[model samples]
Target: MIAPLRSKKIIVTRENAGGKIFSKKISQYGGIPIEVPLLRIDCDDRDENRRIMKQLDHFDWFIFTSANGVEYFFKLANKHQISHEILNAKNIAVVGEKTNQKLKKYGYSADFVPTVYDANTLSKEFLAKFQNPGEILLIRGNLSRDVLPSELKKANLSFTSLYVYKTTINFKSKNLLNEILQREFDFITFTSPSTIDAYFELSGYLVDKPCVCIGTTTENKAREKGFSTILTPKVFTVDAMIDIIIDYINKKEHI
Candidate 1:
């Protein structure tokens, strides 16, 4: 039997390394993956970031919202020679399994992870368990949403946000994105709001192809950007998004 994604050309708009992984997954299903990395991720090495790292012991809990957050946080921590013992002393909370796994790479594990991977669910469930939690530290990227912090504020919880990384548009990908869009593509996958914004800015228009978003947050951004056909998986993961795309193609083929 032919694969569900056989002969389909899917556009991958994730960052560099992530795009390669997504492309590999697409290739496994007989799909042609066009990598058009729209966003670039960089670790923040400012003095302020290091200053915040030095105060890590002051916080009661450390929350990581994305894998990038965990990766860059540890990168900066290691660059500044922050001891693992110091980080291991605090409680860790992550938004998703990927983030938790990233945290584990630094010899730590999450003390709290919500059943759902989205920020909204993380905030809701996190607040349910730790009503009177003390000073918390949020490790995140510059483009991170205010959902978690806003919830903490409403509950009168003290938290300090430390931006460990920043995601910006890959200006070098503009010509490539234009060239790729001119070709026939079956689907476009968006993993974050930054990717969506970068695509729109670089391309100056939205494609009519079916858009696959990793979660509701990205789906909402796609909708806001005027994408008509949007597909989102229940589980917010790249693997789950690929599964959703295969299922979507299989159903469409039957019809």
Candidate 2:
């Protein structure tokens, strides 16, 4: 019986509010999960969030870029008693199916979602859908590096942004740093470039094992860190990463 994740110490580098859930998945997979939050969030413009929700009634469309953005936005809306009628009135747009699923969880459906996931694809789809250039409400987090909004502005679309949550780096996660240096896992998983950035910042250029990342950028980061056999699935999601890891394990078992 060849067990890939079974009883193996798997490194999970998910930070922020999602860290606990991330750890839970690692444990459920029969691996020793480490909970090390590499990022923390603080709402810098708390009042600005309310002000943005207050103006939801003014925009021609609403765009949600992340699942975190959706959760935080609704929390703020419910706090101020923002009615469902106001939420239901707009032409809604979302980045991916996950974002749309989250919206449906809150009793809303995204009228527009890009076929592919990511700001670049969403930006392209939005541009293709609307040519007249109207006002939009873009609800997002602290950092959005992808030039989606810039592309919209270039198309002459006016957007009011609601900054609900801001993410900050954690420089003092000694346990997380030590685990990587000690090489304490059979496998390590990275879901985003930010996860790679936060981890390498702590690990300081030490790599010698199997690693699985969800996308090309993360795979590049893994290669930059000297990981020889990095694995990447077609889609950048946790389930996809798990699937790829299982395939690798199955291949090894057959050999």
Candidate 3:
């Protein structure tokens, strides 16, 4: 029997390491995986990150918007030799299951995870539980949306934004860009708005092929960039996105 993604070429636009994982997932179903990392995540070196690490006990909640935030925050924390005991009394909230998993990797787990995995939904759910908002620390990337911070501000809640990482375009060899553009790809996967923006920056056009987005935020960003066909999984996870893509491919093949 033919595999679901047989003869299909899928473009992966995650960072260097993440793109490899997505590529491997695509290959499992017989798809030709193309690694075209559009963006790279770098940890911030500003003293503000260290300041936030020191005041972990002062903040009522520590919110993480993405896995990058969790990874970079802990990385800087370890570099500064900050003790994890400071976070013992603080509540941790994560935007998605992936972010939660990243937190768990450091021997910690999220106290609050919204039913839906986006800033808008997270703000709503978090506000419903803790009306006061109090002093909060938000560790996120530079490209993160202002939905949560803006919502908190409107509600007169006090919070500090601790940018832990920045996403920059990873446009390397011109040959790679040309290779990606010249290939006939069946689909492309976008994990964040930065990836979508970086892809457009490199390609100078919207994706003509179908796109599979990890969540509504990425799908919305793609739509705003003039991508006509964007698919999103009900559950905002890479595994769920792959399942949706395989299902879509099987259905299309049958038709």
Candidate 4:
């Protein structure tokens, strides 16, 4: 039987002091919300954005990795007075289902999205037809892995990256940490690698409580930061995390 979920608090450390949607979900599941933001965003460079948008016709695909990346890309495009038609390339790619919706908001549907959100899965699926493609314009944040770009190069497909934003530590959340650490929460959710980094920055040890992660990447980050046992949803998402956490609670009760 599933264990009762009541009076359990899970902290969602969103990058930009933004987790309203996540907080709502946790509350719906009987989990109290704690605000401990880990990172903040600032636009780093935009010069390369103009150069690419001006030559938009030269690109075969415009790929996005995050909702943040998609938001900033369109923001920059709109800022420079670039036409919406410039974004209609032969194809478009994104990392997650949510990011696909972000693209839809810009009036251009994404052509490719992974069933599961991750760099390896996204690249393998993209490369199937990417070998015959022309240059691709990969829009991402300041820091990201070279795995995707390197794979494209090996397949002889050219691609250029346009970093639209920067992710920096939110050194302003020290007061928030004191409140969070003083009170022990029932569950802690790690949504990104930076979130895990921020936890250690404040307290050397992770909380002695249940931990949930959105994806394997975040799961690994949590495990590295002294969280030995973490629950990673089979599907990487906030909704998926709920389903998995519910199931895990039941299984642990049986034991």
lDDT of 4: 0.79
Per-prediction TM-score? 0.97, 0.86, 0.94, 0.91
The model with the greater lDDT, 1 or 3, is 1
Clashing pairs in 3: none
Find the candidate with the highest TM-score and give its number. Answer: 1
Measured with C-alpha atoms, the lDDT of residue 143 in candidate 2 is: 72
Q: Candidate 4: how many backbone clashes?
A: 0
Candidate 1: minimum summed lDDT over ten consecutive residues — where?
A: 83-92
* Pairs in steric clash, model 2: none
What is the C-alpha lDDT profile of model 4 across 1-255, one tens digit per residue?
Answer: 322456567787786434778887777777677867777877655676778778878888888988888888877877788778877645888998988887888787888898789877888988885567678888888766676888887888888998888887777986787678778776788787877887788666667787889898888878777786689988888889878777777787799
Top-down lDDT ranking: 1, 3, 4, 2
* Clash-forming residue pairs, model 4: none
RMSD, one per candidate, in order? 1.1, 2.6, 1.5, 2.3
Error of 2 at 195 (Å): 2.1
Instruction: Give model 1's TM-score versus the native structure.
Output: 0.97
Expressed as tens digits, the lDDT of each residue in 154-191 for candidate 1 is 99999999999999999999999999999888999999
lDDT tens readout by residue for model 3, 103-171: 888889999999999898999999999998579999998888999989998889999999989888987
